[model samples]
Target: MSQLILHHYPRSPFSEKVRTLLGFKGLRWTSVIIPAIMPKPDVIALTGGYRKTPLLQIGADIYCDTALIADVLERLAPTPTLYPAESAGLARIQAQWADSTLFWTAIAYSFQPAGLQSIFGNLPPEHLKAFMADRAAFRANAPRMRVPEAIGALRLYLEQLEAQLADDRPWLLGKATSLADFSVYHPLWYIRQAAGVAGILESYPHLTAWMERVQALGHGTSEKMESGEAVALAASSTPVSTEGEAFLDLHGLARGERVTVAATDYGVDPVEGALVLSRPNELAVRRVDARAGEVVVHFPRLGFQVQKVE
Candidate 1:
């Protein structure tokens, strides 16, 4: 089996989600910390243009989104499953809500004046300016939640979660921790990063305890890997074959055709390649990077759009 190589930064909440999953599965992985903002030449060389943080790479196969990356991890270590049978469907639905609605709300709430200080207070002015501009571009065309709206929604959401965790239940889905816990944990975790806005979470005792439990999972065993080394690893390795796998094509595009895949929400920069795998759940493209060699980049079909290059 190819070693799990994660390209992520320390402050990325999605990266934390994957890290905790790795810890839960007790899987050791190679870690490559990429820049929080843009101009990621090495990342672009492998992903083509999908610049989302915390991509999972197994040899030449690069998984773009965390949703797909979670599936890949679950497949790799199935014992501590992300989707317990009892709460599989509900967990997926709740996770989707947390990743989208809850996440955006937390962003609006945590990036306010005082919260901004907590995040960019110590950084150089240029660094803060650059990060702001990079994120502005990233959030283009996505629905935004203003701080006022985010505060109200956050309070309501936290209250609901506190109620859910009532009676000292161990995990979100009864006995075992599922994707819902990780997904919900990350957005609120982001909220906690800003000490100013973080106090909102203190109002909910049960929710706080749940957050502590999730944090206790901790990141699993990992070793540092340089960016060039990660790219070189991709250059030398081979993408696992996806042949004979179920192909569920929603778009008219067929396998082997030139196509571009991009996120439907934010980070809309398209990754161009030959359509390699089109399934009900995933879309992959075969692209050859001069630096990274032949590589297949994969994305989840849910939030990504696939367009055949005319």
Candidate 2:
């Protein structure tokens, strides 16, 4: 089997979520540090035009989105599961809310003036300006929450989360650790990057202890790998065939036809390829590139839209 390789930057909270999950599963992975913003040429060569951070590449299969990554990891390592059977549905719902709602609110609250200084204070002025410009364009489609509104919503959400820990439960859902815990924990984890913003969490003792528990899981064993080497590895291998598997048919595009898939919310760059796998859990597109050769890129079915290419 191809060894797990994670392409991510240190500061990305979603990457931290995957890292923590790797630690939880006790799985080793190869790390390929990626640029936080655009100019992700190596990533684009493999994923066509999808430029999200923290992609999981195994041989020629590139997995985008942490939601799908969690499922892939679960399949690889069954025990100590992120989704306990009884609460699996609820777990996914909670995780989705955390990844979207809670995440945006926490980002708004954490990127205030003081938090901004903590995160980008040392950057050269031009570099900082460039970063801001890139982000503004990236988020052009989504309306941002005002800092004041986000602060209020975050505190309210934290109150509810703190109450979940009232009976000394170790996780957010109930007895077992679920994807919900990791999803919620990551944004809070990002908040702690800035002391001024993280101070808000000090009020909740139970929440603080729980955050410590999550942090203690640590990133699993990893060795650094160059981005060039990862691309070359893809060039040397062929995408695994997904034949005779149960599939989804909501997309009207004919089988093997060229299509474009893209995130509906942001990072709207489209990836064009032949529809290779159209299953309930994932959407895979087979595309060939000069550098990465032929590779099948995968994205979670949720939050992504499929458009038939003319």
Candidate 3:
């Protein structure tokens, strides 16, 4: 197997999820720190256009979205599974809700005035301004939660978690930690990323305890790789599998058809290429980049919708 290369910035919550998974799997990986905002030229070189943080690079294949990244890691190392077998379906459903719903609420509450000041107090004026503007644009179309409403919702969610943990189990579902634990950890991790908001955890003893357990799974083995080196690695290696498990034919579209792929959420940039793979879980588009050579960017089927762009 080729060296696993993760392109991410430290402050990204989703990236933290991947990093923790890396630690849990005990997989050695290469890190390529990327900018937190747009104009990720080097990253676009490999991904064609999708600009989400914490992209997973395995040789010439680039996996976008943390949900898919988790799947890939689980497939690679199944022993310490992120998805538990006893209630696998339930675990997956809960994880999905946590990743999308719980996460946004946490962010909404975490970025309140006090937390924002703590996060940017030390930064230069221009840097802080840039970050704010960048995030605003990133979440342009997303709905905003009022601070009071956000706090109430978050508190309710925390109480529910407390009830789950009260069962005398270490994990949310059962004895072993599963995807549910990791999914819930990252957003709250973000809220607490700033010192001021971290104190709020004291209100929920069970939630805090579970958080400690999640943090213990460190980024197992990793060496920093420069952005340029990561791009070169993508340019040099060939993708292992263009074909995945299942396919959905549309508009009479076939494997060799010329199509475009893009995420349904933020960073709506599209990648145009020869459609190489479309499985029930993901879609792979083979695109040729002059600087990065040929690379295949894979997207989880759940968060993305595909079409034939004429």
Candidate 4:
């Protein structure tokens, strides 16, 4: 098997989730740090136009979105299972809520004045301006929750988590950690990174203690690899064959059709390719670039849309 390559930067919350998961799985991976904002040329080479951070690459297969990435990681390393057999359904449901609702509320709250200052204080003014412009463009089509509203929602969510942890189980679902714990940990980790807002966790002692337990997981063993090296690796490899899985054909689109797959929410840019694999819950499109050669870009069907190209 080829080395696991993760394209991410340190500050990304979703990346942190995957990193911790890697630690929990006890896997060694290659790190390819990408820019915090746009103009991610190397990433574009691998993913076409889907420029979200923290892509997982194995051979010529690229997995977009943390949700799909988590699935792929679990498939690669099954033990210390992310989706325990007993609570798989419940764990997935909770994970979805944490990744979407809790995540956005935390983002809104973390972008408050003091948090923003803490994030950009040492950076040059131009960098900050560029970051703001990049994010504004990223969120152009998405509805943003106001900070005040987000604060109230965040507090309510934290109180609920405190209650869940009140029994001292050491994990959200039970004694063993599951997908829900990691999904929920990243946003809180982001909030903790900001100087002024970290005190928000102090109010919930049990929740804070649980957060510490999750934080101790630490990112797994990683060796640095250049973006160019990662692209070259993809260029030289073939995507894993998806030959046996039955195609559900929800869109009346057949395999080998030219199509575009894109996230329905923020980061709405699409990737155009030949549809290679489609299941009820997942999609993969094969695209080729001069730098990255042939690669299969995969996305979760939950928050994304797939359309045949005209």
| lDDT of each candidate versus the true structure | 0.90, 0.91, 0.85, 0.92
Candidate 4 per-residue lDDT, tens place, 1-310, comes to 4699999999899999999999998999999999999999999999999988889999899999998888988888988899987778888999999999999999999999899887678889999999999999988778899999999999999999999999988899987789999999999999987777778889999999998898898888999999999999999999999888788798989999999998998898999999989887789999989999999999999999999999
Alpha carbon lDDT at 100, candidate 1:
91
RMSD for each of the candidates: 0.9, 1.0, 1.5, 0.9
Higher-TM-score candidate of 1 and 3: 1
Positional deviation of residue 117's Cα in model 1 after best superposition, in angstroms: 0.8
Q: Write model 3 residue lDDT over 1-310, tens digit each, in one string.
A: 4688999999899999999989988899999999987789999899888887889999889999998999999988887988777968878888899889998898888788888887778888898889889888877687888889988898899888888898778989989878888888898899888677668678888889889998998888889989988889888898876555466775478886788887776667788888888777778888899888988888888878677867
Tens digits of per-residue lDDT for model 1 on 131-204? Answer: 99999999897888888998899899988888888978988878889999999999888888888779999899
By lDDT: ranked, best first: 4, 2, 1, 3
Per-model TM-score versus the true fold: 0.98, 0.98, 0.96, 0.98
Per-model clash counts, in order, read 0, 0, 1, 0
In model 1, residue pairs whose N, Cα or C atoms come closer than 3 Å (at least 3 residues apart or on different chains), thus clashing, are none
* Regions of model 2 farther than 4 Å from truth: none
- Candidate 1 residues lying further than 4 Å off, grouped into runs, are none
Residue-wise C-alpha lDDT for candidate 2, range 123-190, written one tens digit per residue: 99888889889888888779899999988999999999999898899888888988988999999999
